[model samples]
Target: MAEPGDTSVLATAKAKSQKSHELASCVIKEPLFSYAHLQVLNGNPLQEPIELDALQVRSYCTAALQQFLGIAGTAISIDILKVDGSDCWLRVPRDSLGAFSAAITAWRGTNENGVHTTFRVKGCSDWLGSLVGQVGQDTLWSK
Candidate 1:
C-alpha cells in the first residue's frame, strides 16, 4: 500500500531535480594530463640516501618499464617535471597513466652499491596546481 503523502513528496522532488538539470548549459570535458610525484626508497631505509639527477631518474624509469613491460614500455613518453634529492615529479600521457604506474610499482630499483631501491608514488593528479598545493601543505605542516 502506497501512502498518498509519500507519493506526492517523491513527485515534487523529481520535478525539481529535472528542472535544475534542464537549466544547465552543455559543456564538453577534455582529457586532463596525468602526473605522478614519486619518492626513491632504498632496500634499507636506514642506509645512506640515494642521490638522483634528471638523467638518472629518466634511465631508472626506462629500465623499470623495460623490466616490467618489455618492448611495449619503451613507447611511453615521460617528462621529468622536477628532481630534488630522492624525490622527483613526472608527467605522462593521460591514457598511459595506468601502464606507467603499474610498471614502476612492479619493478625493483637498484643502486650503485648493489642495494635495491624502488620509486614510490606519493601523489598523482591531472591538475599541476593541485599537486603543487600539496607540496605547500607538506612544508607548512612539517614545521
Candidate 2:
C-alpha cells in the first residue's frame, strides 16, 4: 500500500535483493612452494611417522612451520585419514611444517616478489570450514 505523503523506496529495494547470485566473494592467492613443512602442533594421530620429532632429519618445529605458511599467506588445514593401503602417507618435506600465530587474524595474501604463486591448502585440507585448526592437542586427520 502506498500512502499519499510517503514515497517509500524500500519496497522496490526488497524486490531487487531477492534475486541474488548466491555468490560470496573470497580472496584467492596462488601456491608458494612445491613442497613445504606443514606443522603438526595441531597433530593428526591418524597418520604414521606422525610424531615428527621421532624422525632423524632436520625438520622445522611445528610452530615455525605455521609461521612460514603465514608469511607465505596460506593456512595449513590437514585432513588425516587412516586408510589401510598405500593411500595413507603424505610425504611432505622437512621444511613443510610452519608456525601458527594469534596476530594472524585473517588469511592475508601478497605477490610482491614477481611470482604469481598460489597460497592454498589442497581443498581436502579444509579443517572445520575455517582457517585455524585446534583438536585439543590430540587430533587425527580424517581424510
Top candidate by lDDT:
1
Compared with the true structure, model 2 gives a TM-score of 0.18
Misplaced by over 4 Å in model 2 are: 1-24, 33-51, 59-143
Candidate 1 residue lDDT tens string, 21-119: 545676536455688988889888678888889998898899988998899998899999999998899999988888899998888777666787889
Tell me, what's the RMSD of every candidate?
8.1, 16.0
Quote each prediction's TM-score: 0.71, 0.18
lDDT of each: 0.84, 0.31
Instruction: Supply the global lDDT for candidate 1.
Output: 0.84
Error at 54, model 1, angstroms: 0.6
